[model samples]
Target chain A: MNGCMERIYNGLIKENPTFVLMLGMCPTLAVTTSATNGVGMGLSTTVVLVLSNMLISMLRKVIPDSVRMPAFIVVVASFVTIVQFLLQGFVPSLYASLGIYIPLIVVNCIILGRAESYASKNPVLLSIFDGIGMGLGFTVGLTAIGLVREIIGSGKVFGFQLLPLADVAAGKSGYVPVTIFILAPGAFLVLAGLTALQNKVKNNAAKKGKKVREASGCGEGCASCGGCSGKVFPTGNEEE
Target chain B: MVLSENKFMMSSSPHIRSKTTSANIMQIVTAALLPAAAFGVYNFGLPALIMLISTTASAVLTELIYQKLMHKKVTINDFSAVVTGLLLGLNMPSSAPWWMGALGSVFGILVVKQLFGGLGQNIMNPALGARCFLLISFTGQMTTFIYDGVSGPTPLAVLKSGGTVDTMSMLIGKIPGTIGETSVFAIMLGAVILILTGVIDLRIPGTYLATFAVFVGIFGHFQNPDIGFFDPQYITAHLCGGGIMLGAWFMATDYVTSPITKRGQIVYGMLLGILTGLFRLFGGSAEGVSYAIIISNLLVPLIERVTLPKPFGKGGEK
Candidate 1:
């Protein structure tokens, strides 16, 4: 149980896909112009991720390692198509706003990364939880970036006006949106800022003698060992 | 001379040291910029002054507070922030609210300067970086040039739109543009001071202006039918009517962002000229000097790599 919980915690904070792993940057930067678009893209990716992780884990024994990458792509792409149609039918607005990104989720490194690293090796129940955790982490990162960009760029939150617009023609003083925040450069600026903020938090936690792992290219899990290779699971099962 | 027990001078290279420091050089730059900044105030009135003061104050304050929070030694006394703030202020439209300048200054100092490891480590000129930031963020506010209580299109804008402007008025500082950019005469005066102080030479600005002039003479008439090929009036107006003079003389010659090698400086200058001319002639905006300078600043590393001088007697012998 503790191991299961650790996987969730690791995904949410210690190894967040967007903020920490720095994966799926294409969708993270492109569709995150607003909070709604961010939520839409993130959740769509989450659904695809969860389903793909479960199926890949179930078929892990039959699938040979040589063709595993192609098999993973096929599983992820099938689930992504279903989510695409479901979104198109039920939530047309979100589907239209999310546009090409929904289809592009097949290529999102986070989903595939978890499938190859954790899902293939871990138990069925644990793989589902890993999918959920990583999905939620990506959702949180996207929503935060989208919320900030929306507020500063458009003076809106979730499509609702948060900051009053300045009417220069009427000589009224109020908020002036920094329109560049909605542009492509704003994505980079906000991502760098939020990533830096989290690094500071992680560093502070480390300074207090907390067992915060050092951040390598990916995160604690990937950096500590090669996908937790030759490690004993908390469930009392040891992988050779 | 006998050295005292505790006063031993152990240093490398030549023992002779000049009185010049970063602070001293920055002070000279500040002094050189005073004429243009002063003309901006006179031309634009109280609002320009307020904008200038707010920017300078905010830049210095941001540096001070950032250093304090990060527990680094305070270097605000060196006046680099002051020069950056003032340069950014001069780049701002006079009609822009004072807070915009303040915000730009904070962005320049905190993000562009201090965040990037402060003064010499910044990849781009801080003032130009901040100016571009503000210009993009607040397009309406940054481009509106108001003079004599009426907003008018800048001469460059007029030229961009197939209309002509008075060259003499532009030269005499009666034109509508950004605070310090309207006055060619005032900017030249500052440039002369910068030159005479031995702080800057003509290598970068000279090649930059020369290339830009040649580019304009060749391609400028394509956008406007009225402009003749190799027209002297068109060339002078191109030179005098925008931020090109201010940018070439001050911003492009930034020590940290520009290439150090003499040959590299020439390549950087020519790149600036071509980019500026390309942007002004074909780009969506009327003026492109700020963009040109910042883009060239980004290319300095590549230029330096290409133009690096061979070591003495190494290449020939090997």
Candidate 2:
């Protein structure tokens, strides 16, 4: 129970797939134009991550070490297809909105990264918790970015017009949408901004005598993000 | 080039260094820009004046506060922020709301300039970058120019159509346009000051204007029917209107963002002129000077790499 809980904590905060690990950047940047779309994409990715983790862990010993990569993908893709059909049958609107990204989740680095790094070595139970944790973290990140972009870009969130778009349309001098926040550049700017914010929080914690890792280089790309959020634990925790 | 034997041993190079600080350079640029700024104020009245003050204040204060909060050296004394603000101000329409000025200034100085690394490290001209940002973000405010309840089409807009313009009015800066770009004479006066002080490399402005002239002349017949190829009025109007004069002299010559070597400067200038011609002739907007300068600014690194001064003995030895 303790090890499983730690895996969940590790994925959500210590090694967040979106903000900290920066794993599935394609769908994280795309398909996050609105809150609803972000939630839909996130939940769909979550289903794939969890099922793929369990299958890979179950077949970890059975799969030959030589063809482990292909074996993991086969398992992940099967689960992704199941989620896709489920989404297509039920939430057709979400399926339509997140059109290409749903299939592309088969190649999402987060699923593969966890399979190679965590799930293949860990027990099925711990791997399942890790998937849940990383999925929730990714969901939080995507939804937050979508919330900001939608609120500023369209004055709406989850199809709710909190700022009343009719005022802008009628020229009644109300809140006008920034419009750029929903554009492509907005994704990059918001991503950088959110990443910077996370770094600031971690740095502040480090300053307060917390046992956090010091950020070394300029935190721009994936090379700098690997060891973020104080990856103090040693890898190869087969002892558990 | 000989160094005296008075505690000044002949260093390998850079014997005589000018004592002009970045602050000094910025102050010179600010002084040189005074005539054009005054012309903007004269042409557009209180609104233009308010814009200048507000923009400049915002840029300076933003830089000051940003540096202070970031625990870096406060560099607002270096009038680069002021120059950035003033350039953004000049680029704005006279009828632009007050907040636009502050927003643009802050965006230019803070985001474009300081964020990339203050002063010398910015890759793009901060003012031009901010101007483009404002143009894209707030299109209506950036394009709407009105004075005294009379809003007239800008000379560039008129020229974009097949209409003719008052050449003399454009030359003397008595036309309808952005706050400062309307007055060729005033801009020329400032350009002269910049040139005379040796603050500007005339190679850039000269090649830029010449290339612009040649390109516009070649493309004149296609863009306008009233003016034939190499037509005098067409050439004058193209050169005089649409921030070309302001951009060629001031923005393109920015020491930090522009190419450094003589050959590189000429290439940068010619490219800028060609881009301006292309945009004016075929682009969505009438004025292409801002976009052209920025595009050229981006190419400066590549230009410098290709056009570095040859080692002294390499060519001779070969």
User: What tens digits encode model 2's per-residue C-alpha lDDT throughout B1-318?
Assistant: 555856758667777798988888888889888999999999999999999898888999999999999999988888899999999898888888778788888878887888889999998999998888778767776877685568777888888988888998888887777888988889988888888888996899999999999999989888766667898778888998889999999899999999888899999989999999999998998888999999999999999999999887776644
Q: Give the Å shift of residue A53 in candidate 1.
A: 0.9
**Candidate 1 CAPRI assessment class:** medium
Give a tens-digit lDDT track for model 1, residues A116-169: 888887767667768888898899999999999999999999999999999988
User: Per-residue CA lDDT of candidate 2, range A174-228, in tens?
Assistant: 6657666787777876787888899899889989988555333442432432432
TM-score of predicted model 1? 0.93
The number of the candidate with the highest TM-score is: 1
The C-alpha stretches of model 1 lying farther than 4 A from their native spots are A210-240, B1-10, B14-16
What TM-score does the A-chain of candidate 2 achieve? Answer: 0.86
| Alpha carbon deviation, residue B315, candidate 1 (Å) | 2.1
| DockQ-based class of model 2 | acceptable
